[model samples]
Target: MPHILLVEDDAALAALIVDYLRAKGYQLSHLSRGDEVLPWLRQQRADLLLLDLMLPGLDGFSVCRLVRGISNLPVLMLTARNQHLDQIDGLESGADDYVVKPVEPRVLLARIQALLRRAQPAPLAELTRGQLHLQRSCRRATLGGQPLELTHSEFELLWLLAEHAGQAVSRDTMLQYLRGIEFDGLDRSADVVVSRLRRKLGDHPKSPEKIKTVWCQGYMLLPEVSA
Candidate 1:
């Protein structure tokens, strides 16, 4: 069962959400105050977080930022403030998504399920190619024994490539795997994402060795599975 940390101030609403989510087979931990969130999260492991914007002390945005700084755990902000700026602020603060107050229990559940699906970790068997080593469960990658700093998207892309190591992954295929949709008019965005990923992985686009660009095709992880 997926564990969720729910931070809400209203006792009645919190109870309702907890009951609904628990019925849906989610293991839930509730905290009414934002001040308690960090400590709770540090002590208990949760797959995702459902946070309310208005809380006693700290506020949800700050909590989201603090969590992002330490871990890439998925966050879904629940707010009564429907302003676009509030939503943007939540996202900028590292929330995966946001929901307005007076939310339908069903919709919240759907969003929670979607975020969990997107945040699923890669399989946890060792994957190595040359000096690159990826440990899926921990979401850690090292190149030549040096730790690699990767964003969530970059990690996912690397994991996908490693899964099919040595095979060419077309841009469309990668987009589908990453975004769950065809690039369509977002081809440039896909290229930009890949370019950023290459930079993070220390793979030069020109004369690349680890992740090779195949002209108009896509990318391939070099087949030398060592290190």
Candidate 2:
């Protein structure tokens, strides 16, 4: 199910919309304050955001700006303000669409469905090595058939290693690919990331198996299967 994050403070309106959307088959997560949006998104992924114009902690415009800094998730603003200026401001603040409040449930549903259809992600970019699988498009990874929670940096490192499976990928190459910078030899960025990856992948730090160190070149990801 497509997961949506809803940021609305109205108890009655939020409850009514939540029940309706859930019954329509979309997964919904609701929050009351605009300030909570960024933290929630940092820890979890959502397909879309439903924002309210006038929120307690922060207004929808500021919240939308913050979210746009980190993600391109589609945002639909809802509010009692029907002024065209408000709609234009919301759109300029990074919202995909704006709807005035007290809207018919059927129309709201149609707008939501249309937005989701338009925001569908592109083709998946994936790589597999035995029990390890990485979906770069979604930034999701799995190891030993279990989902692995990885940070943005960790996922990028893992994707680079998997892309060049069975061969040593130079630290310089990885650094450039990930951060758009050359490895400084003094930089421990790759080392720190590799350590974190090892722990998450259950590889022994002292005697690692999945990701192994090269004497001088860099690191290598042992191919789990010959296919």
lDDT (C-alpha, whole model) for all candidates: 0.85, 0.89
| Candidate 2 residue spans exceeding 4 A from truth | 122-227
Write model 2 residue lDDT over 174-208, tens digit each, in one string.
88988899988798898899999999998888999
Stretch of 10 with least lDDT, candidate 2: 218-227
lDDT string for model 1 (38-107, tens) is 8887888999999998899889999999999889999999977457888999999999998888989988
| Cand. 2 Cα-lDDT | 0.89
Question: How do all models score by TM-score?
Answer: 0.55, 0.55
TM-score of 2: 0.55
- Once fitted onto the true fold, the runs of candidate 1 whose alpha carbons sit more than 4 angstroms away are 123-227
Q: Note each model's CA RMSD in angstroms.
A: 14.0, 15.0
lDDT, residue 17, model 2: 86
Measured with C-alpha atoms, the lDDT of residue 22 in candidate 1 is 93
Q: Give the TM-score of candidate 1.
A: 0.55
